[model samples]
Target: MVGVSKRVEAPSQGNREFTMTYANFAHIRDIAYDLTGITLSDHKQNMIYGRLARRLRALGLSSFDDYCNLLSEDSPELHEFINAITTNLTAFFRENHHFDFLKTTAFPNIIRKNMASKRLRIWSAGCSTGEEPYSIAMTLSATAGFSQWNAKILATDLDSNVVDKGRRGIYQEDRCTGIPNEYTRYLKRNPSTGEIKIREDVQEKIAFKQLNLLHQWPMKGPFDIIFCRNVVIYFDQETQKKLFARYHKMLAEGGYLFIGHSENLNRVSNDFTSLGKTMYQKK
Candidate 1:
């Protein structure tokens, strides 16, 4: 009699195929804009999902929804989420031509005009780790009697983790591959870690900070040269335009802005005049 009643299976909500929901994408997009002033387009949904999925697993959360709820709970977690998602790939003398332009043209001109002051201010915006600023320091150090002059470099990045690493001035030998042999000679190898670390002399000349470019900058600068290369590609057109305008305001008259090989400021911001091939001068 008990078997006479037919058993009915309740409708299974079986294995919900994971997809990046609009709500989830919007949450990530807002965080990016709030932290870095970079707007994530709808096309970057997959990127957001890929970058943040690990956070979910780490926290033992089974869903993106739960992970986001955790992020909202504390400022530290929010920072971790932002740092995880921001791209910070950079290398020393990444585009050789820009440095060549600096060595052959810009440096000579600046030194001549400011001989009395013998002062130079360079800012490496979006400087991931320490390569670019260290390269600039090496270049200045190589110039005869540069130590006698008032020369300094300021390097900043959005990720606090990378900024801390940059401040430490340590690097693996493999990452220093493209670094010139002369510069390598200046680096000291730690016996314990077998890691190459920038000498204190070179490191002392540069300062590193965690800066979110989209936010109000703390330092007022009439910087002689600003290297913000390869950073704007992640931003939308509007964000790029606004950022360039801000950069123009920060530059000293006749100062230069070096952008990525793929970037152009021609139509975006009229505050700068094209100086040819990824170089622009503030008007």
Candidate 2:
């Protein structure tokens, strides 16, 4: 975040000639892939230009080449660049069924099985702006006997800016729209700011950290449930295979793994058994 510039200017309304070259685009794509494991295709060249153009303008750089040159050097701007380009489109309960599964099936089984210890661990991988992890927290808290269980959740994203927001546990009022009615009790309005805030009970249950799924994880444990929805859709086939394999190894036997609605595991890794659309249990 230190290296990334914060200055932003609105794009001129009409079409403008592009300044970036194919080589520059290729380099940017490579950087995103290598650093974040996100595949930025050629069609997204205009998008890359639009997004990075802000960074260039903020830094007062003359050209895309100037920006490309910084990539080869040790620059903190790279951190901001990924944060800018990486998509963070999410809302409370964006995928309702996944949370439904957690409340109805997965969590009930976990609560039943672990009643003695009353412990639960959930990972919200690629948690954007804390909505996903907070959603998990609220769902668990609303469950019967949930307070009796020592529930913990790990929420992570590659974007530091979003991670910071997640840590703050605040959002605009409209962002609370899609959250379920039952869980709305945990959300209260900040009278001064008119913004939504996740209650302390739900907020404290989660630990949000900045993480790149491609990197070596310091954690070791068989997580009871992992919510990696929509994160792997950006990765290539090989990367997805390796990522899922690592997840399989980390997930407890019979633990649940939830993926994006549009993502599938066909021909990827067979370490998990499919439990219908966008759901798998580690085999």
Candidate 3:
């Protein structure tokens, strides 16, 4: 029902190993929308085929219809299906401006505003691997007085694989190259192994969990800041509306919302006032 961009005839079966009929693609898109609020456009058919084909091969399923049937039965492969479809491209300090904004504005404002409570809560929704939340943790650790404050970050993703990876806090050495020199103190590098790990103290500041944005959230939050960057771009306008409304309810007074560079709240929801560079403050 959701993300039905268009209907087109299935492509010619030239040299392809498996068949992905239009009906099969349609069913998969519907399932994806229901499960993750992602709008899979027609252009993504090849990508979807490429990703899910591995599952088909692994399960020894011969065709998309068979795979669809397995999914229809709510097979355990559903998790793998979601994981395959979701994108996890990320980097340390991927959007440097957001961190800069935090260091210069949000953190100071929150520090002044919540001096009595000395509490800070941040959520990194759709945190791919550990980079985004680790970046947040590094930023917080670099802040002068936050060490004594009750600061915690919640990092969550729909993909269980990435969630587990994030929880481990280990990454390839090159994956951390973009981390600022000043914030590098929070990381440790294994010289021989070429692996980088977030220090235990910094790692302790975050809690990683596998979560679906479309599902019920377990934690009751009036979070001070939420970094849901590059996430809502997948959802349709209606889905975005509901999501932002929920975010408005979850945020503390004057809480900040940081979105992706390519994402905009315009024509989606007016619950937050845009602060430029994809940053927003709850109205």
Candidate 4:
């Protein structure tokens, strides 16, 4: 889209606006893909302009060219750029069926299969604000015999802001509304501020970290379950293929992979067999 110009209206002080030339948008698209494997479609031009314009204003720059140059130079503002471009949408047990499957079927099988080891490892990839891992902890806590098991949940995301929030384990009361009544005991509600925090026991089960899926991973995992829901939908098919292949390698044999409702293994990967409802089992 180089040389193609899209006018973006900025705040009017003396009738000035920013123009996002095609080159600027292209540079952003490439950088996003190279840094995080997120593919920004052409239709996302408006969104790109909107999100990046704030950075320009914050840095006191007048043009997208200046912003792009700063990014090229690998300034500290790169972190802010990634944060601004990334989208995180998650909730406690957002897809209720996945949790149900975990509690009713997967956990039972895992418990029996690992009777001798009594160890469990779960990774909540793209766990926004910690809800998913906390929910997992609650479900495990409710399970029989789980107390005797050595278990941990690793929650990670590309956004540092959300990872920090997850580490804090705090949320406004409404953000936790999806939590079932039975799981309510795992939360401590603040009466004065109407905020909720996961009980320390549950919080301790999870470790939150900032991670880019395209980058080299720090942990060597034979994870029993991986919750990468809603994350790969942002990437191109080739990227998704490579990512799923990496996931297949990381997972223990017969481990489960839960993805977004709209995503599938079709054409992208053959390493996992569909268990239905956006869930797959490693082959």
Best prediction by TM-score: 3
Ranking by lDDT: 3, 4, 2, 1
A best-first ranking of the candidates according to their TM-score comes to 3, 4, 2, 1
What tens-digit string does per-residue lDDT give for candidate 2 at 1-283? 0122232332332554337777777778878887888887667777888899899888889888899998864688988888989999888887888889888899889887888988788999999999999988898988887876778999999999999999899999989999878999999898999999999988999998999999999788679999998988898888999999999989877999999998999989899889997899988
**Candidate 3: pairs in clash:** none
Report the error of model 3 at residue 71, Å: 0.6
TM-score of each: 0.87, 0.92, 0.97, 0.93
Clashing pairs in 4: none
- Note the Cα lDDT for every prediction shown: 0.80, 0.86, 0.92, 0.88
How well does candidate 1 score on lDDT at residue 250?
Answer: 92
Task: After superposing candidate 1 on the true structure, give the runs of residues whose Cα lies further than 4 Å from its correct spot.
Answer: 1-19
Per-residue lDDT of candidate 1, residues 68-134 (tens digit): 6676644567887878888888887788777778777888888887789888899999888888888
- Give the winner by lDDT: 3 or 4: 3
Q: Lowest-scoring 10 consecutive residues by lDDT in candidate 1?
A: 1-10
Compare the candidates by lDDT and give the number of the best one: 3
Query: What are the per-residue Cα lDDT tens digits for candidate 4 across 226-277?
Result: 9999999899888899999999999988999999999898999999889999
**Tens digit of per-residue lDDT, candidate 3, span 1-283:** 6745658776676888998988999999999988899998887888898899999999999999899999965679889999999999899999899999999999999999999999999999999898999999988888877767999999999999999999999999889899989988888889999899899999999999999998999999989999998899889889999999999999999999999999998888888999999999999
| Clashing pairs for predicted structure model 2, backbone only | none
What RMSD does each model have against the real structure? 9.5, 5.5, 1.3, 3.3
TM-score of 2: 0.92
